[model samples]
Target: MAPVTSGSTRTRSTASHPGHPDLAAYRARELGRVRFRRALTLLVMTLLMPGSAQLVMGRKQVGRLAVRVWLACVGSALLLAAVGWLWPEVLFRLAADTTVLAVLRTGLTVLAIGWTLLLIDAWRLGDPLRLRQKQRLAMVGLNGTVVFAVAGSLLFASHLVAVQRDFITTMFGDGVASAAEHGRYNVLLIGGDAGDGRWGLRTDSMTVASIDEETGRTILFGLPRNMTNFPFPEGSELAAEFPDGYDCETCTLNSLATWAADHRDLFKGSETPGIDATIEGIEGITGLKINYYTLVNMEGFKSLVTAMGGLTLNVRDRIPIGVPVVDYIEPGVRRLNGFQTLWFARSRESADDYSRMARQKCVMSAMLQQLSPQTVLTKFEALADASTHLIETDLPASEVGEFTQLALRAKSQKVGTVSFVPPAINTSDPDIDKIRTMIDDAITKSEQPSGSGRKKGPGFSKSSSGASTGGSIGSLSSGYAANQSADLSKVC
Candidate 1:
């Protein structure tokens, strides 16, 4: 079969010879027209974008696209700048620096580079459609990034303050010191059954420890809860000043709770049973002006201990029998979980609150020791978690940091622990005056001038003449006994 030329080919053969110059010229013109139209579109689109510099007349499509991209870039840049200015933290945390300013600068740099590249791409592409697509994608990504940054910044700002506040609460807790002596800190470490249904509320154990970091000395005085004396300050005028409902009288400070419980009329106006008056009474008893006071209900203690991990304690003697619900703690060093520690603190069947108070002090001392840098680093994550849940205080976070720094600087510093128990200072009968004297002496001794050492000395020391022999533990009834014999090394 012969290969046939189509009818159009035959007509072309007739009209013009195969090597015609005019036909070649016509084909070149058509291709040129198409390219020109595309370039024009690019130019027009470029003009639509911000900054007409990219939209040259020749390449309409490419120029127009370049203009559109430039506009998008400019818009995104402005938005990012505003975000950085308004919510620096958005950039800060993403950049992850303690310094806020540094993070913002870094975010701005990233935004500028990213937008500049998008603008360049729009100019290179001659097709308006392609340019528009790229610009839209860039805009979406940029806007989304800024939105996430803003949200993150807000959350970061909120958490920053919260974390610091939590740290401060752990340090200066309860803000007991007055502004005049703001530098002076006092911890009224109390051991008590706080109105649990099983037992009425009363301060079972009280130890007023004064910390004069300025002088580098701490005075710890143990006050028996059962002592009978001028409970509501010593003077009659001061007693009269209290709420009339309390029925002002000289009685055992420990009895304040029992009395208040019996006479609910006294606490009618108050939500927190006579705490204010009780604080006043405490200051009067010790004659040491109190600046801050904190009342911790039972729940707070257990949570706090658990957060710090189980506390470490040196068991002085065999727990003998277990307090119901809580197990028997064997004699020796024991790592106690939160529930165990609380049970150990509250167990009065085998020992009185006086002994309990000593145990609490021992636990506190152990806690301080465990809070060292070595311990902190070992369980930093847990410590941080526990800290947030278990504390309330007025001291600022910065101050807490300062204290931590101070503590860390003196790595070799010694923390002395004492419990005022049997044989240290006897309280056979409710001798309020005698107890007061002992507390005063302990505070005075702690604050007394010392050499390189800043810790509290031995709780009780015999004078040169030596006093009369003290009575045996069996003879003492309802008398105060403390674990004054201290092995000071365990404390921080």
Candidate 2:
């Protein structure tokens, strides 16, 4: 061997002997750099493959299990995304299902905890204590940042799921589901207030939103609150009492709720006697089977508008603020706040009930058009809170997912409206048979293909010859544009 020694071998052996101070220092520096690179590589592997770091430098069994779980989770997510893209209803169903929400919440919480632990283990495998001071600090910083960021996001998602579940459970009831009648769902919408000296909440404004079961085309049948001599369903309690029609001076449609509340015995086993009685009245008038009823508290509704960041309305005229006219909401296309909107929808100091009804319809149209899914998601918590206080309904929670889908569909279509006010049908003595026929005709027309024998209303024309009756775009006798328009948006 001594005879066969080459120049290169002799130089390497001299360097290995550590007799040369500079050579030994160079070797130490190279070794440190190699260790640093190895530690950095393990951290990168942990980030990219979750358990690959453990497989190479830590427990092999743990690494295999972690990698398998990570793969399964990723695969399941991709599958769900694909399915959701193909059929969006499935996603809505999952979102609405309480059991699904609970499972999701639990899974998110578990993933947060599990992923944090895995990251900690990966950091430990990197052996940061053996790393140089700067490298160790860098690894610690990176691990902590990644752990908190991922865990925080998961935890936040879980919290949102929990909030939605609670909102659904608390807001909706376990009421019996009502089937759609004549291929349409007639939901009675009542807007009113429960003030002092009132027997119950007054049915100030009432409209039956008859929506097509399949197409979601809706026709709003605005029944005047002062409608008198209206017969109820023949077999109902109110019908028996008002067999000759509610023909007294105080026996108007709006007064029916108070009348029913005063005599609760008439509505036995009913939670909302006023609303149920009002629904019967509406059914008796429109001849449409009521599927459900949503009673909105006028006072609390202001909060909902505020939550939506106010509603943009075309205020045609100056609307008085208070009953005695304290302030005025200036005209033009303006974004009105909650207070102004409530006043715009409810104030009748100088306006007739019909004009107010027209404004309300405009408000509804604006809300439908402007309240996008993105807006709802962004302002969900605020909207949810306001809704709980604003609305009361017999709509079952089981049907929420379906109704949500219908609403989305409704948003895409034009809303047809029919109001049974003066000149068309006298509120004091409305012709029941004629009103029913008109409703049936409207529904039939709405179900037809767009632009097929359907007349569009004069939408928001400022230069029209029509008189501006109480800030609305038409005279009471001629009919407010919003009240009887094919597209309410035109008038608004």
Best by lDDT: 2
Candidate 2 lDDT, 317-430, residue by residue in tens = 788888688998888878889999999998887888889999999888888767788889888888998998778888888889878888877887789999999779988888
lDDT of each: 0.49, 0.83
Q: For each candidate, what TM-score against the reference?
A: 0.52, 0.89
Runs of candidate 2 exceeding 4 Å displacement: 1-49, 194-200, 451-467
Tens digit of lDDT per residue, candidate 1, span 1-492? 999899999878765865677667666677555554554454344334433434443445644665565566678669768976896435333322223334434444544444344344433453433334445454446444644554455445445434433444444443232542434456565555544451325666666656665543444566666554343555533365453322334456555655555565655765435454455566665556655444554545676677666776655544533436345766545777777777666666666556566556555555555656566655555565654544323443324433344343223333444433444444333344665676555555555544565233221212212111121011134332233422233321
lDDT of 2: 0.83
Worst 10 residues of 1 by lDDT: 466-475
